[model samples]
Target: MLFEDEKTNSEIAKMLHIGETTFYKWKNNPKFIKAQHEYAVYQFDSALPLAVKTLIEILKYGKSDKVRLQAAQIIFKRAGLFSDNGNPELDKAKQRKAIA
Candidate 1:
């Protein structure tokens, strides 16, 4: 019901002849809340491929360096090429210093 239809909570409750408070109370349950979060993640995962493709296009043909750099940063981050401090070079330098 939540995924198939984009109805509001009040609408869903009304259709089931329940009150708004009842709807909210049920929605606030831990399991129900988890399902909602999982469904949202599922929707985003389904669209992620298209989003990645568009970001690639922006990186390749963006009108300005600022825009292209931003896109490139996102791609790098998603590709697991970033370090904890967000700078791969800095991370390498730190590793070398620690070795020394």
Candidate 2:
């Protein structure tokens, strides 16, 4: 229940047959928090293929020019084409890391 997405505390508690306060208590536990983070990463990894496909689709055929450009910019940013300090030396370092 804790790993379920888009579920409110009260809703999850009801589904689990537990009190809302108990649900909150479990949510506050450190181990539970760590497990939640792991589960979220697993879920994201599982959805990554579809997410990449959607981004590519938007970059290719988005309705507005601005939207398409934004999508392209996101792709370039993720690909590390732009550097934060606008330093060519730093960009070359990153390119070398990618090649290595």
Candidate 3:
């Protein structure tokens, strides 16, 4: 139900009859963040726009490359197949050669 048409935290809080502060506290919990990330990916695969919104939400609070990688993977998987030719992960040297 997290991916329902109304996906904002405020909207969810209202639907669940919880205060915004409670919702924020829940979102800050590690367990809740992990679960929410997984649910967001599932919703993304189901073509829910809220999934993308959720990913962005998670990214905003993420503090590590691991989290960013997870977000990137979700985006890549949903967008299309990728190849090394245009890989954005490459170093500057690789990018210059590719550009040349």
Candidate 4:
């Protein structure tokens, strides 16, 4: 509830019938932090397939060329083929091609 809930800490605390200080203590606890991290990972994992599908749909069917390009860039960046610092794998591939 602490994670998936959109309510503020105070509001959630009120709903949970706990004091604000207690809520803060729980929120700051190591176990709570770990649980939050795991929950977030699960949520992201569950959404990943749909997220990829949406990105593909956008890349293929976006109304504007700019939007389609942005989606393609996102896909490439996530796949490690595009990066601001340049990809070493890509450089290695180019070097191999040069040798060939």
Residue-level lDDT tens digits of model 2 in 10-30: 898998999989888999999
- Model 3, residue 28: what's the lDDT? 92
Of candidates 3 and 2, the better by lDDT: 2
Runs of candidate 3 with Cα error greater than 4 angstroms are 1-7, 44-83, 86-100
- Tens-place lDDT digits, model 4, residues 14-74: 9999999999999999999999999999999999999999999998999976677778778
Candidate 1 vs candidate 4: the TM-score winner is 4
Give TM per candidate. 0.68, 0.68, 0.39, 0.73
Estimate the lDDT of model 3: 0.71
Query: Which numbered prediction scores highest in lDDT against the true structure?
Result: 4
* Candidate 1: pairs in clash: none
Q: Residue 80 of candidate 4: its Cα lDDT?
A: 87
Residue pairs in candidate 2 whose N, alpha carbon or C atoms collide under 3 angstroms: none
Instruction: Give the Cα lDDT of each candidate.
Output: 0.80, 0.81, 0.71, 0.84
**1-100: candidate 3 lDDT, tens digit per residue:** 5545558888889988999999889879999989988988876678767767879877666777566555765676667754435445564454355335
Write the number of the candidate with greater lDDT, choosing between 1 and 4: 4
Q: Give lDDT: candidate 1, residue 95.
A: 45
After TM-score superposition, the amount by which residue 6's alpha carbon in candidate 2 deviates from its true location, in angstroms, is: 4.6
Candidate 3 local lDDT, residue 41? 83
Clashes (N, CA, C under 3 Å) per candidate: 0, 0, 0, 0
